[model samples]
Target: MHVSSHHQPLLVALSVAVAVFTAYVALDLAGRQRATAGAARWAWLGAAAVAMGGGIWSMHFIAMLALVTPVPVAYDLTITLVSLALPIVVTGGALALTARDGLAWGRLALGGLVMGGGIVLMHYVGMAAITMDGVVTYDPGLVALSALIAVAAATAALRLAGAIRTRAQRAIGAVTMGAAVIGMHFVGMAAATFTFHEGKAQRWFEASPVEAPVLALQVAGVTGIVLALALTSSALARRSAERKAREVEATLAEERQSSETLLRQSEERLRLAVQATGLGTWDWDMARDAILWSERTYALFGLAPGSAVDYTRFLQAVHPDDRAVVEAAVRTALAPEGDGRLEAEFRALQPDGAVRWLSTQGQTHFESGASATGERRPVRLLGTILDITARRLAEERLRASLQEKEMLLREVHHRVKNNMQAITAILQLEAAQVADEKAREGFAAVGQRIQAMARLHEQLYSAQDLRRIDLGSYFAELGQGLAALHVGQPVCIEAAVEPLVCDLDTAMPLGLIANELVTNSLKHAFPDGRSGTVRIRLFREGDDVVFEVSDDGVGSETGERAKGLGKRLIEALAQQVQAQLDINRAGGYRSLFRMPGTRFTAPDAAVAPTETVG
Candidate 1:
């Protein structure tokens, strides 16, 4: 009988297909070594080894099944099972060693020894399981060649396993690895030379050997299935890890949302506070030159609420006369040397032509981005605007009313002064016609006193502040009038007065006291035609003002001077002003009135005359 060695084209092709697919699956599974760690790593590693080992074993067995001879051939059950187990165990351990993250040449070589040794053992051992077959012999050279190919391919595949990145690279690597594995198998097959023993083939049917074609189909199908499962498991594991990561991210997002919610609530509360105070806020982004105004701020600027506005528009809306003031204030606030404060009171011109008095206060805030020139700068301008039109209008109206009252009061003072002057003129005319010297002197004294009162009214009517009087100026005029009345008298009136100011009430009593003292000095101080000086000195002593009038004439410790109507009037006037009165006759006739200084303003140097009547 004649037989051809098993080289069935279909079986060879089937083995090659299994080799290629298993190589791809192993390469794909290699990613798991990186994707997983701990116990999970070992699990994926086991799956990958199965695909690689099974493919090598299945390819060899299918090639064996392709050989046909006149003698029957069957495999020993124990040896065949052993051959399959050898590759799975050896490749698993080898792959685990190679999966140590980096490609050290020693580790790769060691891995190749384990993987190639197991594959060679599986081929030779499965060949040994053949029962009723002739002695299978191997060509030493070809056998060595097969082992070399297996080892080289295993080492190359290990390098590619870690390096595989994209689908195309993995596919290319798979094709190359598959070719080496298939080539190694075919080389091993070629080394085998079967020498049949005639008549021994009849014993094959007694053992009931399985059909070789059916066994080849089973090996190819099983190898394909195992490779598919390994790849599928790796993909599922990756998906599970990603899902857990997504869950963690979702949890973090929720916490972030809560924080943002609290911030928004705080902002809302601040906004409500501003609204309650009737303040309109503005935020300006200086970098963008953009202005964001609160609803109330828009209304304050006389613009339609919620409308878009910029600095240019804001300036246009300001009253023309006040525009420069507004610009200058902003410029000062933005200056590098200035404090970041802005204050401006300007009139805002509305679209409808109504004008509003607006007071704006702002603070500039600096930030890194506010750096227009890549350094620190003021980037934000935040402020408030208040409508002060009502307050301003009220102030104007009150001022006008005060002016009206002042004019009416001045008119009243003028009328009183005119009436007093008319009475003085009548008294003077009547006194001039009288023959009695004592009576004429009495009329002249009364008329002079009345004139003094009229002069006070004249001062009040001319004063800018009607409620206060300048005692220095008033006394100067009073002294001149009294001196004029006593023409050719031996007394020279000399006043050394400070620029003292006092209220109407205090000044009136002080004026009358001065009049009484001066009149007495002129009437009684210089007896026997003695020439002397009447000195009026007004100065401040501590918290009281002193009004002193002295004369270098007749001395008086008098209770005698106190008996007269002028003295009585002086005492009453001093008492009315809450002034302490002292009479000293040791040096000369001196009367001092000390009035509380609280009723007087500080002496004004500006209002003091360069020259005064003596």
Candidate 2:
């Protein structure tokens, strides 16, 4: 039997509209699936597949419901439910395969085949659920055509779902995917053949197995549930992504603020340190021959702030005599063979024609690599300069004062020598006039003491260092003079003196002490014309300066010497120099004095014996 059918225009339009909306929902869910990971990704894929299957089934069921037949049409309850699972399971597999970060041709082709086969089964299996007294079958050629259409539609739908991203593109993809699904449904419906016997009309509307309207309502409810789930999940995902974005921006802002605060503090510290040190900084760009000076640098050169300067201008500001040397130092710093270091001191000429000494230090920065036509060259120079005018002027004044002091010291020594010589002359004249032998001896002794002082000043006047006097040399010379005092006495005075240099203040006291001791030894120890050797020794023993005078002639009695002027003089001189005097007369007369806390120029001064006869 031939069965004639036509679709209700409004229902057909509703079916098409439902198909498009379902495609849109499925696409939104797939987009969410691609963005998810772990278990959530599979969850979204299942949701997308269920939504797409429910939507495609609803479109096909609604179109079928729109077609009016001559007999009442009903569906088997179990088969109708079983037919719905075909699209869902197959779509889930297809989406899981292709809905990811990427898609490949092989996966797409395989997914299309599975999806198309599932759709064909969904349509035909749905037809088998018909519970009429008629038979349902399909023409082989039409069925094959419907299968091809399903395959083409499935391929197009998967491609569209994968490619769709923006709202505008999604809308277009939804419409196109909806049309492909609708075409597959129509082709599958066209392949179906309904064969009815004459009694099939009697079973119409008599407690039909499944009514089309009730089934339509059930499918619509399922479609609504899938739509609700897909939309709500998408909204929540969008909200989560936006919140994360805001958090990241806030963290970045905080980090930026902290970095800027540190940078500002560092710059401020550098500026303050430069100001406190009176240092001026500069940077030079060699390629442009341009110079950049800090505010302190401008003040150093007596130039206005923000004034442009170059190497030529810098040389013009330098003093004429020191300009050439400064230029040479800069060239050396920039030389390829050098370490790019510079230190130079020169005079800077201020605009007011006054000169200020400037000390500059700098470093050059060179290119890391050579250019095509040349070797590496200096690209930039950084440096600092400081004013040293006050220091230079103070040094000059100090030098001049030192020279003046030296001249005054020389004059003092010379005048002292002349004054002592006149005193010695007076003492000599008095000694010669004295008739009493003992008093004449005293006068001669006083004259000799004065002569020794005169010789000291003379030696000091011509000495290399005015502040120090060579004690051994002075004592040796003084012994020669002492030996001259007793002519024809047949006594030998041997002076063993060490060349120990001592401060000038100790010279007079030490010389006078030695003179008295030696004079005492000669005057009394070798009495009755008997001759013996008198030894005068001066050397450093341990931490003390030692002076000893000893005689082999009958050792002088200290009891008798205590009443003489020489003994008292020796005691006074020893006290003046803080010396401890030890007198020993056991073997020979040995008078020794050790001055503590005496410093010598050399720790070990060579000693040599100097002899004179009296």
What lDDT does the true structure give each of the candidates?
0.83, 0.81
Kindly report which residue stretches of model 2 are placed more than 4 angstroms away from their true locations once superposed.
1-278, 284-291, 304-316, 323-344, 361-383, 437-441, 459-502, 511-614
Clashing pairs in 2: none
Each candidate's clash count? 3, 0
TM-score of each prediction: 0.58, 0.53
- What RMSD does each model have against the real structure? 11.1, 9.4
Where model 1 places Cα greater than 4 Å from the true spot, the runs are: 1-262, 306-308, 366-377, 433-435, 557-560, 603-605, 609-614
Which whole-number lDDT from 0 to 100 does residue 309 have in model 2? 91
Candidate 2 to truth, TM: 0.53
Residue pairs in collision within model 1: 6-66, 6-67, 6-68
